[model samples]
Target: MDRSSDAPPHPAQALPVPAWQGTWRFTLPPIDSSVPQARHAIRDLLRRRAAPLSAERTHGLMLILSELVTNAVRHAALLTPEIGVEVTVDPHWAWVRVEDGHPYRPHALAASPERQRTGGRGLLLVQATAQEAGGSCGVRATAGGGKVIWAVLPLDRPTGRPATSPPPRSAP
Candidate 1:
């Protein structure tokens, strides 16, 4: 039997999404390996749309997507089937939404050095990244019983972590 046909794709070969301007959505099998693929997909989506992200923001997006997708994979099963990742962008912001097969919860513990060593800092980092980009993080229960955790990042925010968007370019 040809085993190549049965193997999962290498991370770089994970997706070839059509170029889209406003939004791109993906449904990946709920497995651990999907995490990196998800990150690459989002990065490709941003680049294909001609949206330039600061290096800091790029790093933030990778961390947030990895954390969110890893959490969803933990809760996935036959009943769940798939996990959804959505990337949407507008003139001023880029938003990432991950839909999981679980319900939303409001409470989260503050992350500390000790706690982080044990691997519980996902949401803490996510929320911090959102705020750092002049945006917000939120969670809500979907009508179908799953949960969606999202972060909205400002597109115009400075790459150097400055307090405001770059000044508008003056007309030539």
Candidate 2:
């Protein structure tokens, strides 16, 4: 009948490594002008993780993040005061998610003349950029009553063998 005896045994502990490896999450207040800040944060996170990213890839990430955040801001404007954006970067990919109070799923903007007339192209940009980076993008409703528009970029370097020794130099 001893209470201490009824408790489960503690689990074994795992040693921590000196190297840094884990997901980094950031929550930003919904600001009217947060695109720039979002880009900066994503860049910093990627750099800190030592991601093998090039300048072009970095710019792509920034653009995608900006677009996603902007879409969330625009579509979920009414949910902003109580909502925020979350950006996460892991070893293999980076993600940006906007949390709102609404439960609507994000739909890609059509390219019809009427749909295009309104100038709503954020989702299109996200899909194209993600595809260009050898990645994929999509949206899903969260269990907590909101939706997340996310894009994943592969960390692997582009195809093509690394450069070997230069061709034999011509006689000087």
On lDDT, the leading prediction is 1
TM-score of each: 0.73, 0.70
lDDT of each: 0.72, 0.63
Clashing pairs in 2: none
* Candidate 2 wrong stretches, greater than 4 Å: 1-21, 82-84, 87-91, 113-118, 158-172
**Using alpha carbons, what is the TM-score of model 2?**
0.70
Clashing pairs in 1: none
Alpha-carbon runs more than 4 Å astray in model 1: 1-21, 76-79, 104-106, 112-117, 157-172
What's the alpha carbon RMSD for model 2? 13.4
Taking the tens digit of each residue's C-alpha lDDT, what string does model 1 give over 1-172? 7799888989998755423337778899888889999999888777666675777887787788888888788754444678999987655567788887766553445866666466656788888887776777778777888878887777653233543542222200
